[model samples]
Target chain A: MKWDFTSVFANTDALLAGAAGTLRIFAICLVLGLSLGLVVGLGRYARTWWFYLPATAFVEFFRNTPVLVQILWFYFALPMLLPFEISPLMAASLGISLNSAAFSAEIYRAGIQSIDRGQWDGARALGMRWAQAMRRIVLPQAIKRMLPALTNRAIEIFKMTTLASAVAYVELLQQGKLIASLNYNPIEAYTAVAVIFLVFLWPLVQFTYVLERRLKRDE
Target chain B: MAYQWDFTPVLANAPLLAQGLLNTLKVTGTSLVFGLALGLALALLRLSSRRTFAWPAGLVIEVFRTTPPLVQLFWFFFALPLLVGIEMTAFMAAVVTFSIQSAAFFAEVFRGGIVSIERGQWDGARAIGMNHGQALRRIVLPQAVKRMIPAFMERAIELMKTTTLVATISYADLLFAANEIAQKTFRPLETFTVAALIYFVVIFAFSLVARQFERRLAVSGESTVR
Candidate 1:
């Protein structure tokens, strides 16, 4: 078969649908990741032995290891440890979210720790409880510090969703693989996938730069 | 037929596990050297005097850095051979892909150090009649390298974890072995956990070494600066 470069985009509709699936996964995983990360990050900062020990273990294991293994474990082995059945996509989301949470927790812990002690005292003087003070004052401020790193990490997780191809999710990378199998044009199939990702990321790159500049000027 | 992890399978496969560990380190070691070399060249090119040189280098860095390593790995394994008509073995493909992909990141980090090596140092090197390359190798790189140790170690740990992605293309790295065990015994939990542990050990050891190197380099750098 002659090498074909334009065949993967033969059906624009299917490509768009695949892009939607990828973004959907991204949105779901990001929300789940931040929530889980919040708890882990607080645990790290609080230094409560219970939360600290477990959070440290969780963060270290996930951060130091490969997300691919985490995904495979969730899809292939995790459900067996439980009584309920889970779909592959759910499994992918859970694994990616958990792995990402580990990272976000580290970032959050660092971001929160970077805040000045003066802020905490001011909050206490304002008659706020520890929880209230953290929510209203500390978190917002820390999140600003965390945003740039978080943006970089978010881009990382977005790129990693391509690995969902392993557990048989039809995200963009897997979709491109399937297209390649059918059309026998791997370059166009994968290049089209790269182009699709570039479209998502190029804007994100600019947005991160703008956010950084905006944050810098505000500070 | 319920499944719970029994270590017997992993224990029995100890030799294979050792082989996997060695392979992971080999890939990491070789790629670090090769990636650093390519990355340095790219970093130099990006900071070159000519616009034509800088633009293409910047483009290459953006393309690889923004994209996923898995895509790059797959592209090289499945498409590059077809695109360029040269077949690579699975291991070769992994090294090539990782070195090329990681060079983008390595270059950026290196660029940070090179650009920050105090403008006076560059002037001094030029005053002594050193060309750009000599100035870099003799004066700029030594100073930049001292500060760059921390970043290099961090990137190394990242590269180690990235080796697992090569498993997707049937490369028998640690994760691929774990995948085989998972498939045969339906014990993905045990296999992957153990695999994760092996990676952690490799990474942690590297971290310890990196810390030592950092300390040593700090002493040398301080003396040299003085």
Candidate 2:
């Protein structure tokens, strides 16, 4: 009956902490995922079957399944497989990062493939090793080309961190659920969290649009 | 560390998992149809010549697309009942949420396809004594649907993946069943792994089928073009 947000505002600190948790996981996933994706993407681009096969399989398996399922697996199954006990937070992060890595590998591969064949040949003509050519001639351009898609994926990963709540990671959505249940104002609590997410994500969407335009202009 | 690997508990829970998988498919299949139909309406509304219809439709699409599906599920499950003063079953809540959330994404897919249809095609249809509706139905949509296939498959995969979020609302979907089994047997690893494998197999199979469909469509499209 009421549209009041008094209770929602009262828990600003908790909400902010939740937002910070979400961002923390997003940043860690971005760093780890991009690096892993680069290696896998390079492997996929490699001429050697040994490098290509496993990388392709990893990407396919991870990409095919849902991230939520993967997170649950990491939280539960991974602890059984490894000797060290993994915290729920750590498990969620690893699952999310691996999922992101699979997607990023595809994006990076597309970018690298988009470059002219002459570029690779030119690098080889300069007597550079495969690694050196990829580093010196290929990756810089691919990074630029893949920036928009990668940023979009970053936003996706950021949005997906809300899934960590299912594993009890106390992220933004989980905090909202807690606040809503505690205050008994589910409408107001959810609205506040949704607004916060919108504020955070809207800019990234706009940034991608701008990047797309700039890239198109350059082309 | 010689911890014995055991699948006994997980295997014993096969019926429950199978039931969960069925529920998942039912939810996904029903929502996919509902979402696409609703999305078609939304896309048309947004593309309408009238500002009154277009702006509201655009706003609805933007808000739903921008927010997380998990939050949207929570909103439908927890908040809607509060506002309406009527309790809904978790399955009902999930179906409603998934439908609307997917409608937002599917609306974009339709809009993208519709927009890509050349302006001259519409005029050509009109030149052939077709009305606006006829032109859209007969001329524009056929070509547009082809362009929309790949995007549609991508969204379908996403929708299927997102169905897992219904578990958070206690809908007894595959993921929820896995969690329940894990809790009961104290074999979280085995239970979750089984669930994950089920998910991977289903999705991978669908992806293969979709690829083949795309290829067939492409070949037919080329022949028609020639």
Candidate 3:
């Protein structure tokens, strides 16, 4: 079959809207996930057993299962579990955020652990409280060290958002699939979408590589 | 008000779920074996002296790595038949799609492992008159494989989760089975909850084992160096 790429262009407006939807989910999830990660990471990093135990359990549960299943669970099951209904978009965002949070927690834990013990001692010696030392000293360096890993998580979250398509959330991939089914030319349709994803992701991937190298140089 | 739970439907469909789990494992295991071989080849191709081999290999890895695996699965399951004029079962499409997609990632892991070897080791092998192939196979890979184990296991665990994507194409994997039973029984919550638990248990156990193996490997690796 001769591939006719022109057919994909017929629904350009829809595809663009879908791209925006994808970005919106990514943006929301990024903020929520990072905040959750910080909380969980701090909990796990703390000496107290109560905080550590729940944090560890949360991370393990989210990390171990597939995000696709999680999304499905949120979409179909959450309504049953909870008192209210959730839009498909909200479910997808929640699922992705919770999943990303688990990975991010690990990244944060590793980053916090990588900070020199002496640095902590120095902060304490300066008469700063524990919270102040963490915020004013340890977190800054840990955030720098964690930048590449966090960026990678961000990218993974972006990719996982495509699973929103399964929930009928009309993301870029879903819109492309709709177009393909309409046109009976999935090759052309999906090829264009793949190119769009490549174009979208290449810069972020490059940025991570550059950031990693720059951070290494400072060491 | 509290919600009432029902697991009777899920329990009755245990055999179907078991079959689906077997299918999921089959798809993941076969793809993993082939993917590892293809990934190692791509890694070598990327590192080859000849630009002819390296350039396209790089492009393939970049494209595959960057795109969502679901799109790849759709492309294979739906579009490829029209393009190639060859029909495929959903399982075949999944296996092929996953192998190709995973090769891109595993290639990176392999490359990282190979590059982690000290420069002197490569030079020492060359000094002993081992050709590139001999050195890679006999010396470098033996050492590199140890370093690669953790990454490889991580990828394998990832691939196990990924096998659920086959359900999108109507392949009756674990997720598909759960979805079917849920819809049939009008018990989506309980059915899905059971399915999620199964996945968590399987993957969690694998991760625990991998962590243990990795710890042991780290100790052994350190001791050997000492």
Candidate 4:
């Protein structure tokens, strides 16, 4: 068996397109997931049942189910109920973003909960309401502690973008499939794809490690 | 017009879905067992002072942990066969990929648990004339494994969810079964909903049990490693 990557390298345009698709979805999911997660996390942290119960349910349902199932459901089943068709990008984004939101909500909740009570008390003493305290005092400090975990979530989200390929979204892995089938070079094609992901993610993974170590040292 | 909901077709194919669920469990269980064993080996190697043993194990863990499971699955299923000159079945591919992928995760859990064991435990074992391996097996591991239970359970649950990826490679796991049923019955709404619900029930039950165990450990004042 000989190793050959000329076939893979020859299809630079295809791979470049896949990388763009991967980055686009990753950006969408990251922004949507992290922001929505803050809302849900706050809901979970709420004292009232109305806020807590629904947030808990949303987190539980999304966390327990596989992301692939959710993506497939959105892609295949959801259109049945909707007036218009759901695109691959839309379905995959919905599944990944919601799943990331559910997972990250826990991170946010834990981050918030880890803050000292005195911080809240001090905020209150300064004439701050709940919203004001959370936005100005609690979240700023909490986000520092949450940074490492949030970075890890971002990595997971990046890895998950590949699953969009299952629904035929033109992600990195999907393009690898195209190259492999076209060139009959699954070995080179797949290896190149894996290498590309490693190149993209390894630095991020190392950065998270650095953040974790620094956080550990600081705390 | 309202899209009328129907479950008749989905219900009629209960047996197929059930079989799929069983296959899903089968893959999960198989992968979990192998992953745990391989993970221990990798952890041990990684923890070794010898650079040769530790470096390769670290590479394997990082590479597997870093790559997406679906990419690993495709490589094992498609690329491996031609490289190794063997016929790779979907089940075999799924098992191999998930076991290794999950093993990479489990390796960290083992390393963390082992590291969490205090230096005094090692000293105490050595004072009693126990060798390194003997001390590890008799002293360190027994204590470490207890602390690792929560982490192990969490990784096991993640592995179960990941088994769904096998469906992409044409493995007739629960999700694949759902696809076939949906196509055959043209009741994708009902079919996928049931499939997702089934996964939720099984995985959620496991989560509850794990949480219960974690609580017990907490009540006992045992610090568990993540």
Clash counts per candidate, in order, are 0, 0, 0, 0
How much of the real interface does each model capture, measured as fnat?
A: 0.65, 0.79, 0.69, 0.81
TM-score of each: 0.93, 0.96, 0.97, 0.99
What tens digits encode model 2's per-residue C-alpha lDDT throughout B1-226?
A: 7767799999999999999999999889988999999999999999999999999999889888888888888888888898989988988888898888889989988887888888999999999899999999999988888778877887898899999988888888999999999999999888888898899999999988877877887787632110
Residue A125, candidate 2: alpha-carbon lDDT: 96
Give me the runs in candidate 3 sitting further than 4 Å from their true place. Answer: B222-226
lDDT of 4 by residue, A1-219 (tens): 999989998999999999999999999999999999999999999999999999999999999999999999999999999999999999999999999999999999999999999999999999999999999999999999999999999999999999999999999999999999999999999999999999999999999999999999999
Error of 3 at B178 (Å): 0.7
| lDDT to native, each model | 0.84, 0.89, 0.89, 0.97
TM-score of 1: 0.93
Each candidate: RMSD to true structure?
2.9, 2.2, 1.9, 0.6
**Which candidate ranks first by lDDT, i.e. highest?**
4
Query: Which tens-of-lDDT digit does each residue in B1-226 have in candidate 4?
Result: 7999999999999999999999999999999999999999999999999999999999999999999899999999999999999999999999999999999999999999999999999999999999999999999999999999999999999999999999999889999999999999999999999999999999999999999999999999999999
Isolated chain B TM-score per model: 0.90, 0.94, 0.95, 0.99
Error of 3 at B80 (Å): 1.6
DockQ of 4: 0.90
DockQ values of all predictions: 0.61, 0.81, 0.81, 0.90
Q: What is the TM-score of chain B in candidate 1?
A: 0.90
Model 3 sits at an interface RMSD, in angstroms, of: 0.8
Question: Ten residues in a row with the worst lDDT in model 4 chain A?
Answer: A37-46
Q: Give the clashing residue pairs of candidate 2, or none.
A: none
Where does model 1 sit among the CAPRI classes?
A: medium
